[model samples]
Target chain A: MNVGLLDADVYGPSIPHLFGIKQKPDIADNNKINPILKAGVNLMSMGFLIDEGRPVIWRGPMLSKALFQMTYGVNWCFNDRELDILIIDTPPGTGDIHLTLATKYLIDGVIFVTTPQLLAVKDTIKSIEMFSELGIPIIGIVENMSYFLESTGLKKDVFGKNKTKLAELECLARIPLMESIAQAEYIDNSIFSLKDCFSELAFAVKTFIEN
Target chain B: MNVGLLDADVYGPSIPHLFGIKQKPDIADNNKINPILKAGVNLMSMGFLIDEGRPVIWRGPMLSKALFQMTYGVNWCFNDRELDILIIDTPPGTGDIHLTLATKYLIDGVIFVTTPQLLAVKDTIKSIEMFSELGIPIIGIVENMSYFLESTGLKKDVFGKNKTKLAELECLARIPLMESIAQAEYIDNSIFSLKDCFSELAFAVKTFIEN
Candidate 1:
C-alpha cells in the first residue's frame, strides 16, 4: 500500500530528513524512522527539514491547498503502490485548513489525538465535530503524553489527573509519555524523536484498518 | 457604547455604495454605520492587511494578537459614551482568532448563528462546545436563514424539510429567511443592509447590558 504521510503544518518541516533516510537506509535507519512518506508544506526549506528541530508556523486556506496538492497533486512513494492508507497529522485546532479538507475531501476516517485534559479534549472534540459534520467517520481518539512511568514504581499524568474520565468521553487510547520520546536530539540522523510513543499509534493504525 | 465591528470577509459586491460610505469609517453619528473594520479577504488579498485590517489577516498568533488589539487596542467610540456593550462579529469555525478571544477575554456570552438543517446545527453545536469549554457562557443559539418564504405564501426549509426538529436540541431560536432583507440591500450601504437583516441583533445588544 502506498501510504502518504502528510506534514500538516502550515510550513513543511518533516520531509527532507525523511527523504534522506530513504536515500541512505544503512546510515539513517534507526528506531526514529517513522516509515512514512513526508509531503512538504509551503514556504519550506530543505535545510530546515534535515535539521529536525525547526518549528513550522502557518494558518488556514494555504494549509488546505498544500495538503490537497500533496494528496492529489503529487506522485508519492514506492513503485506502483496502491494508495490504500493516507495518514494525515493535522495542525492543532479547528481552523480553515482542516475545514477545507473536511469539506472538500472524501476522507475514510480521522484519528483525533490530544493530551488527556479538559482543554485538550475540548480541542479534540471541536476537531472531531468538524470531521463528523463533514460525514468523516472518526475511528477513535488518541490521548498523547498521557502518563510518566517512574523507576520507583509510581506513575503520574503530568498534564492532568482526570485522564481516564476524559478518555471515557472521547474513547481515547492512552499513550504513555516517555523521556525516550524526546531524546532523539542527540542522534543527528534520527528523523523523529519518539519511537515508543508511536508503536501504540502504529498498532492503532493497523487495528483501525483491519477492524 | 463604543463597539468595533469585525468580520474577516467584511464586504463583497453585496455591500452597497451609500453616500456616506467609503472603504472604512471610524464612527457614524447615527450609530447605524457598518464599518468594514475587518477588511478584504478577497482571494488575491487573503494575507494582505492594511493599517486598518491588521487585526484580521495575520493568521495564528498574529490573528490572535490583532484580535486582542482590536478588542482592547482600538480606541472604541463607545468606550466613554457609557459603553454598555461591545459587539464583535467573529469569523466562522474554530480557528486562531476565534479561539484567542473565546479563551482569553472575559466574553459575556456567545450566540452562535447557524442555518437550519441537521448539518448546520451540528456545526453550531461544535461552536457552542468550543466557546463553552473555554469557560465562555453561550447565551443561546440562533438559527438564521432557516427557511425560505416563497412568493406563493408557502414556507419551505431549503436545507432540510424538518430542520426545526433538529434545531430543537438546545437553547435554539429559529429564524426564517426573508426576502425584504434582500430588498434592503438596495439602500446603498452595508450598514443599512445589516439594519435590514438584523434589526433584532441591534436591539439585543442594546438591552443585554442595560438592565
Candidate 2:
C-alpha cells in the first residue's frame, strides 16, 4: 500500500524521532514539499523543520497556517504514484488544529486512543463528541496500556479495568503495556512483539473505511 | 498555604475530576467569577462551565479569550483570605495557552513532568526551552511513572530508562506507576500512597520560589 503519514502535532512532532528521520524534506518543481520516505511510508512533520528541543511557540493562527501548509503544500506522490491513504496524527486537543482539519478536510474517520483511567476516558469522549458533532465518523477506540504481564504469569491491571461504556463505540484493541513497543525507536530493527494486535486493529480500520 | 488551581488545560480539564468538584462557580456582584472551594483550596476550570462530555470546540482566539476571563475574571479570595499561590495546570503542547501564560503573567517558575520515555522527555524539553526563553525560571522536573513494581519484588522500567541528559535541571522526584494514583478519583478518601514523593516535590517548589 502507498501510505503517507502527516504528523500534525505541530507543538511536539514525534514522527521525526519515531521514524528516526532527521533529514529535511526537499521542494519539488511544483513548489510542494516532498515527504521523506522510510520503511515504506512517506512522512512529514514540524520536527523536521526545527532543531531538536526547540518549541514551535506558535499561536492559533500560526498553528492553523502550519497545518494548511503541511496538508496542501506537501507532495504525497512518489514516481507519479499517488498515495492510497494519508494518515494524519493530530495533537490531543479540541483547538484550532482540530477545528481546521474538521472544517477544511474531508477526513474518512478518526480513531480515538485512550487509557482505561477516567480522566483519559473523559477527554477521549470529549474529542469523540466533537468529531461526531462535526459529522465525522469515529472509526473506534484503541484501549492502550490496558494491562501488564507479570513474570509470574499474572495479568496486572496497570492503569485499571476498562469501566467506562463508550456510548456503544467498538474497541478495536486493548493493547497491553509493553516495554518493547515503548523502546521501538531506541532498539534498531526490533520487531514489535504485539504485531498481531496491531494487525487486527489495522484490518478493522481498513474494513471500516472501505464500508 | 491557601492555594488556587487554575485548570488552563481548556481542552481536557481533569482538575474537576481529580479534585471531585462539580459545582459551577458563582458570579460575584462585581462580575468576577467566584472559584469553587474544595478541601480548603480554591479551584477554577472550564469543566465547571460546560456540560460533562461536551467538547470546548473553540478556535485559538476563543481559547485565549476564555483564558483571559479565567485568569482575570475569577475571584480567588475566600472569606477575605487571598490565595497564597495559584498553580495553573496547563495542557500539553507549546501553543497559545502556554504562550499567553508566559507573555501575560508573572510566572515564578515551571515544573515539568514526564515519564522516563524518550518521546515524553523530548516534548518536556521543548516545553522547558519555551518557558526558559520566555524568562520563566526552571523549577526542575518530575519524572512520573518512572517504574512499576511487580508482584515478584522486581522493579520494571515499563516505559524505559531515563537516558536523555536533561541539561543541569534537578529531578524533583521519580514517582512510580501506582494504580492508587490513577484511581484516586474513583476510590474516595484513598490517601495517595506516594505522598512522600509529592511532599518532597512541593517542598522543592516552595524552596525554589523562596530563593
Candidate 3:
C-alpha cells in the first residue's frame, strides 16, 4: 500500500531522523512540493524547510497557514495516482494545527496514543473528546509502556494497568514497555521488531475502519 | 515573596494537584474569579473549573479566550494589591497558549525547564528562540533530570549529558534527578526541600532582570 507521512509537529519534527532522510523534498514549478520517498512511503515534514536548531517562531495565523500548506500544497499522489493513506503526526495539544486540519480536510478518524500513566491518560481523553466534538470518528486508544519486566522474569505494571474504558470505543493496542523502543534513535527500524504488537494494531484499525 | 502560579496548561492542569488544593477558586460579584491560595502562593488552574473526567474540547478561539480570561479576568491580587510575581506553567509547545500570553502580557522573562535529553533540549531551545522573537527575555534553561545515582554510587546521565550552548544564554540550574520531585503529588511542601536549587534559580532570575 502507498502511504504518505506528514510530520506536522512543527516544534520538533522527528520524521527526518526516523527515516534517516538527509535531503529535503523537491519543490515543483507550480509551487506544489514533492514528498520524499523512503522505504516505499512518501514523507514530508517541517524539518525539511527549517534548520535543525532553528525554531519556527510563528503565532496562530502562521502555524495555521503552515499546517494548511503542508496538507494541501504538498503533492501526495504518485504519478497522478492518489495516495492510499496519508498519516499526519501533529504536536500534542488541541490548538491551531488541529483546527486547521479539522476544518480544511475530510479526516477519516483519529487514533489516540497514551502512556498508561493517569497524567497522560487524562490528556489523551481530552484530545479524543476534542476530536469527537470536531465530528471526527474516534478510532481507539493505544496504550504504550504498559508493562516492564523484572529480574525475576515477572511482568510489572510500571504505569499501573491502563484501565482506559472509553464508552463505545475499544482499546486498540497495548504496546509493552520495551527498553529497545525507548533507547532506539529511529522508530522506523525499531517498529519492525514489534511485529505482533503492530499486527494487532493493524487488525484493530482495519476493524474500526471497516465497521 | 508573594507569588501567583497560573496553570495556563488548560488541557492538563497540574497546579491544583501539585498544591493539593480541594476547593475551587472563589468568584466575586464583579465577575473576577479569585485564585486559590495555598502555602502563601496563590494558584489558578483549569483543573479546578471542570470535572476530573470530562474533557474541555475547545477550538483555537475558545482556547485563546480561556487563556486570556485566566490571565486577565482572574483576581490575582489581595485587597486591590498587585501580585509581586506571577509564574505561568505552559504546556510543551509553541501554540495558541504561548502566543496569547506573549502578546497579551509584558512578560519580564521566561525560564525554560527541560530534561537532560537531547530531544528535550532541542525543543526547549526552539521555545526559547520563540520567546526571544516575541521580545520576551530569555532567562536561561533549567536542566531537570540531569543525572541519576547508580547502585555503585556513580552518577550516570540517563538521558545523555545536556550540552546547551547558546552565545547569550546560560545554563541556570542543573537539577540532579530526584525521585522525590517526580513522585510527589504536592509540590508546595516538596519545594522546601530543594531550597538550594530554587535559590540559585531565583538569583539567576534577579541577575537576568538587572542586566
Candidate 4:
C-alpha cells in the first residue's frame, strides 16, 4: 500500500520502539530526512532522532518546528516511489501540536481512538470538537480495549461498557484487549500479525475517502 | 491530613470530572483565586475555568501562565487552615509543564503510575530521568492495572507481566483492574471508595517523605 507512518507524538514517540528500529534516519541527497522502512511500511518518529530514554524538553515553538520538519522536510518518496498515504500518530491532547497540524497541514481525516472509559471518551469528545470546529472531517471512532476474552469463551468488559454516547459518529471497530497487540512492541513483532482484525476499519476509511 | 490537589494537566483536565466539580473558583479578597473545597480537599483545575467540552486550545506560554496562576495565584488556605501537602496531577509527558513544575516549584517527590506494559514503562523511564536530572526525588513506582481478578478467584495479567525492571525504586503497590475505580467518575462517585486500595501506596509515599 506504500504507507508511511509519522510519529507526531513528540513527547512519547512509540513508533521507533514499536517497529524495533533504533538507527537514526539518513539525510537524502535532496536534503530531506529519509524515513525508516520496516515490513513494507515507511516510518518516522522523534524516537529515531534522539537517544533512548532522553526527553524532548521542547516548548510550543520548538514543537512546531519539529512538526514542520517531520511533515514537510521528510522524504516520503522511497526509491522514487511516492507514498500512497501518511498516517500521523499524534499525542493525546488538543494542544499546540494539534493546533499546528490542523492549521498548517492538509489532513484527509482524523480517526479518534479511545478505550471504553468515560474519562477517555470525554477527552476524545474535546478533540473531536476542536477538529470539527476547525472544519476537519471526522472519520470515525475505534474503541480499543473494548473487552477481554476468557478461556471459558466469555467476553469480559474489563474497563466497563461504552455508555458515553459519541455524537452521531460511526463506531468503526471494537478492538479487543489482545495480549498479542500489547506485547507486539516489547517482543519485537510487527502488528501486521493481526491485519485481519482491522480489515473492516481499513475498508470503512477507504469508502469514506473515495466518496 | 490537610491535602490540596492542583490539576496541572492543562491539556485534558480530568480532575473536574473525576471529582464531579463544575463551579468556578472565586476570587479571594487578597486577589488570589480561591481553590474549590470538596470533601475536605482544596481542588483547582483548568476544567473549572472553561465550559464543559470546550478544549483549552492554548500554546506553551499560555499554559505556563495558567499553571503559574494555579500554583501561586491560588489561595491554598481554607477556613484559616494551611495545606499540609499539595499534590499536583501532571500530564503524561516530560514536556514544558513538567519542566516548569520541576524548575519553578519546590517539589518533594514524584510518584510514577504505569500499567503493566513495556511501552508505558519506557515512557515512565524518560520522565524519571528528566526529574532525576532536575534534582527531584522520585518516591517510587505504582503499577496500576497490574492484574484483573476473575469470578473464579484467578488473577489474570491482562496487559502482561512487569518484565521491565525499574532502576532501584520500590514497587509501592500493584493495583488490580477494578471496575469500581474505572466507573467512579461516570457515576459521580468519590474515589475514596477505593481508598483502601491505595492505602499501602499512601503509606509508602508518607514513609519516603519522612525518611
Instruction: For candidate 4, list the clashing residue pairs, or say none.
Output: none
Positional deviation of residue A48's Cα in model 3 after best superposition, in angstroms: 1.9
The model with the greatest lDDT is 2
Residue pairs with colliding backbones in model 1 are: B1-B78, B2-B78, B18-B188
Clash pairs for candidate 2: none
The sequence of per-residue lDDT tens digits that candidate 3 reaches over residues A27-141 is: 8767899989888888999988888768775666677788878878998884576897788888776767777787778998888777666566667777777788779887787
User: Which lDDT tens digits does candidate 1 get at residues A1-211?
Assistant: 4555655543333344334332321112222222333333221222233333222222444556666655555444333455566666655555555666677777777887776654455445555655666678777777775655554445655456554354344443566654443222222433244455566666766776788
> Candidate 4: which docking quality band?
medium
Give the per-residue lDDT of model 4 (tens digit) for B26-55: 998899989998877899998888898888
Q: Highest DockQ, which number? A: 2
Question: How high is each candidate's TM-score?
Answer: 0.44, 0.96, 0.83, 0.95
CAPRI quality of model 3: acceptable
Candidate 1's docking class is incorrect
DockQ of 2: 0.81
Per-residue alpha-carbon lDDT of candidate 2 for residues A121-209, written as tens digits (9 for 90 to 100): 88988898899999988889888888888778799887778644554578898888877777576425544567778898989988997
- How high a TM-score does candidate 4 get? 0.95
* Model 2 misplacement above 4 A: A186-191, B164-167, B186-188
lDDT (0 to 1) per candidate:
0.49, 0.83, 0.74, 0.83
lDDT of 3 by residue, B144-193 (tens): 76665444456656556545553246888778755456445466465677
Which regions of candidate 4 are displaced past 4 Å?
A186-193, B186-193
